[model samples]
Target: MVSQSAFAFICCLSLLLTFAHCKTLKRDVKALNEIKASLGWRVVFAWVGDDPCGDGDLPPWSGVTCSSQGDYRVVTELELYAVSIVGPFPTAVTNLLDLTRLDLHNNKLTCPIPTEIGRLKRLRTLNLRWNKLQDVIPPEIGELKRLTNLYLSFNNFKWEIPKELANLPELRYLYLHENRFTGKIPAELGNLPNLRHLDVSNNHLVGTIRELIRVEGSFPSLRNLYLNNNYLTGGIPAQLANLTNLEILYLSYNKLSGTIPSGLVHISKLTYLYLTNTSKALGLMERARLSLFKHFPYQAEYHLVPYLGRPLLRTNHSATLPHLTSSRPNMWRFSLWRFFTR
Candidate 1:
């Protein structure tokens, strides 16, 4: 049998090895820091310091989820959309390696989206909406074969939708709204068999919305269709009626003047119909908005947003406004999952 001193030495070695491994992950975080730093996105993501992963028996970090067993390697999902963080996206994000979802919306972040983002092989949902982002979307983004939902709305993007985006076999929700994109919606989008929500609203998109609608089968999963506020001409395709699952339709504020398709208004699941600037009606002023917001009872995953620059709703205006137009509180959010599978 080993002497007690020898046993203690072995234990010390094992502890040292474990500590070294944990420190390695810190290197990964620092790599991310560098990427986020240069791009200015570190400003929005700076809350990383507030993370409580080291707390005993608990790990609470906003927009982050972790695996339940073993060392609990980060099967992380970062959903910080509309969190008001600003700055550029960095190549270091691909370093997270285990990340499945990344949502960064409504921040003031500016710069070209790095092509390296496509290197995130495990990524699932990627939403970068309502930021000041400008530049061409990298065709390399198609490399995200596992990608499901992709939102790139309200930025200053000006490029043809890459034909490669259709290669994302798992793609479901695709939003390219309110940008400067100027091109025909590629017929290849129809190749995305699992596509559900397709919104290309408020862009400079031109030409007929294409004939892929006649492909003889319904995109059973397809739901909301938002093609509003564009220069797209030509009649609304009757083939659109075949999509039995079609729901919200926003065709207002476009050059398309054809009669509304007969079955459209009556689609069984169709709800929250929006038209020219109708969604702008959803922005309620301060007191009125806060009234709808019940204080979050438990600890929040994300830090509380400051009142400064937060949208305020006027109580008087809310009373007069049509309640039908308002969005559900934090409609873009999904439930937090405590148990993650790696």
Candidate 2:
């Protein structure tokens, strides 16, 4: 009788939970419709937990995640990439008090992003790239205190980057390339404690690029930086050399003038380089001083087969060299080469 009573009690609790879950789902769907209407012609195949009347698996529906017991109170993540969705940023997501991640990248999303997005307290990754988003980035975005990866590239966004972004204590990767953003890079941007990759290229931004290199004192975790195709007109910032982990650099198609910063001589870890069409002289920026391979005690050797066709450096020099610089089938015919070999 005790076991039977316990089973009946558990069954009663489950029924109550199902009722509560259905109620929450109805509320969430009502909220989503507001966003969908603003989207107009844009359509997304999004799954938010499940349609309360869904015929299949209830939990794994398009943009929906569920609680362990299949309840509806917990909303975990929203990844809506490449969905071809259009129109303004959705503000109804604020109602999902428990949503952790929100991604709507590679879509046709338009209009200024809603400032209410800061409500996603647990949001860790927010990707809104490859959209038609315009206007100045809202400062309220800094309120997503837990953000890690932020992708806002390929849009018509303009004006100064919001300095309030420095408030994000855990921000890591930020990609804002190919936009209409103008003005100097914010000084406070250097204060982001965990910033790693920053790509703000292909914009109309003007002014010096120094503050972004070592804004406060150092850039311990920064790696890749792409600021090409802009109106940045000045000497390369010397502090940029302090970024030891920098591997890839693209500064082409800018109005930047003056010689490359001498500090670049010490950046030996760089593997990819693109510094063409700038007012800065090219010859001076070719080489970087590296820890001598021989002196580095037992360093691992990463050998590459000789690349004789094109210079590994991505420069304006690719056209000048014959197909192969080291040797060509025609080079053997020279009498001077035969005599030197003998």
Best by TM-score: 2
TM-score of each: 0.63, 0.70
Please report, as a residue range, the 10-residue window in candidate 2 with the lowest summed lDDT. 333-342
Best-fitting candidate, measured by lDDT? 2
Per-residue lDDT of 60-170 in model 2, one digit per residue for the tens? 445555443245445566666776776677878776656677778888888998888877777888888889998989999999898898889898899988888788889
**Model 2: how far residue 266 lies from native, Å:** 2.3
In model 2, how large is the Cα lDDT of residue 245?
Answer: 78
Residue lDDT tens for model 1, 160-238: 7777988998999998988889888776777778999998887888786445465757465788787777776666676
lDDT of 2: 0.64
| Global lDDT scores for all candidate models | 0.61, 0.64
Give me the displacement of residue 267 in model 1, in angstroms: 4.7
> How many residue pairs clash per model?
14, 6
